[model samples]
Target: MDWMMLGIVLVLVFTVGFVFAPLGLGGGMLFVPILHYIAGWPISGELILTCLMLTGVVSWGSGLVHRREGLMDESIVKIALRGAIP
Candidate 1:
């Protein structure tokens, strides 16, 4: 990647990591669509793979933080899954 592109990516990474992270919004929600709409990245299987890669890391880290804060609930999780799965 060129320097400009690299810099934009770093900015996006830190922007998502710093801003949305505190509110428990993972970076991918902001990153992926920006990549798609602004950066003109293709909406394809590759984007899905990229989203998984980035979001998985953010989500795992967020999970750890939430677990430490004792903010996770099993019953609520089950309830959400019950609705989401169908």
Candidate 2:
């Protein structure tokens, strides 16, 4: 990818993370559509994968910070994890 395109993508990703982190919103939904439709990026497997991974990483990072700050409920997290596991 060109430097400019890479820079734009990075900025957009950071912006999405910044806006959604505190709200505990998943940016994958918005990121894919914005990048593909608004930013004119091609809708492809690679793009989708990258968006998913980025969303996971950002969400995890935010969750970690909140957890460390004692904002998260361990019991709720345990229950959610149990339900999420098949």
Candidate 3:
């Protein structure tokens, strides 16, 4: 399972997620450089996986925040999702 690789990835992802979550900054910017240079993960698959992971975590975190604030508008989110759907 490449636990070392996965552990490093999870740590980096979650740390970046926690840090950037509040500032509304996404992890895509950091993920590529880190995966390519720091972790030395392959460019092709790493990019796709990192993006998917970031999207999921960031969206979930934001949704939780909005939910807590009572400002999570389902209609708007649904509309955005629909537009994004292929």
Write candidate 3's Cα lDDT for 1-86 as tens digits: 37898788778877877787766676667877766766676779757786778767886787789779988788888899888889
lDDT digits (tens) for residues 1-86 of candidate 1 = 56787678768866786766667777777777866865667999998787768777777787788878999997887888788676
Q: Give the lowest summed-lDDT range of ten residues in model 1.
A: 17-26
Better of 1 and 2 by lDDT: 2
Q: Give lDDT tens digits, candidate 2, residues 1-86.
A: 67787788778878999889888885887889767865678989988998888888889999999999999999999999998779
Clashing pairs in 3: none
Candidate 2 stretches greater than 4 Å from native: 38-40
Model 1 stretches astray by more than 4 angstroms? 37-40, 74-86
Better of 2 and 3 by TM-score: 2
Q: Which stretches of candidate 3 lie over 4 Å from their true place?
A: 1-11
On lDDT, the candidate that comes out on top is 2
Model 2 backbone overlap count: 0
